[model samples]
Target: MLLKKSPSNPIQAASMGINKTEDQAISGWERLRFLYEQPSMERDLSRRIINMAFLTGFFFGGVATSAQARETFERSNIGQRFLSASDVLKRQADYAIVRFAKSGFPMGFKCALVSGSIVYADFLKIFHCG
Candidate 1:
């Protein structure tokens, strides 16, 4: 004959929903603490931390090296093409401005840098050049 298994403690029964009201009364932090106390949870947390640290270091190192490489490239002749292009554009713009002035039309021009910002701060407007 097999004996029927039974709860060995009152709180065990209360925790098992035999006392649904008591279980519902447990705070969210208390529930999280209970789940976090498991060995499986501890192992998972440690693994996640290690993975995150590795990824962060890899990305940070990549960005630092790329920045240095970009600076070096910008100093080379090929990279100086950007400045030559800008000068050509300015010449064309100046020619257009002279033509527009001779035409005497109500035309206006603003030659702002590509990497500049227009900012409004406390009733003051400022144009920042890159």
Candidate 2:
């Protein structure tokens, strides 16, 4: 009985296939070394431009929502006069801007506006600073 021909005794074939991939590791390392040695200024600049555009859009959208929220909050005058969906959405959008900007901040007005439900928390402050 030839153990090599037996499917149940295929341990040697499995180990040989694994060693074949390991043998090509040198070629993979050489290819990586070639790329690593080349200049990447163009890639770097393109990456920077893409990053800036993304960040600008993010902050600009946040600021726009904040402004709209401010208008809604002011119209309500501390939300005592009216409480429409637009007003609520405006305040929420503005609060989201503040929350996104002041990440890792506590849930209060001293550090940032109190966002979320009023029943669980206190009043919401719509005030902003220059």
- For this target, which candidate reaches the highest lDDT against the unseen true structure? 2
**What RMSD does model 2 have?**
20.3
What TM-score would candidate 1 get against the native? 0.27
What is the per-residue lDDT of model 2 for residues 15-61, given as tens digits with 9 covering 90 to 100? 23333233333232333233234444433443455455555555654
Q: Using alpha carbons, what is the TM-score of model 2?
A: 0.30
Best by TM-score: 2
What TM-score goes with each of the models? 0.27, 0.30
Which residue pairs in candidate 1 collide? none
User: What is the lDDT for 125 in model 1?
Assistant: 21
Error of 2 at 57 (Å): 1.3
Worst 10 residues of 1 by lDDT: 107-116
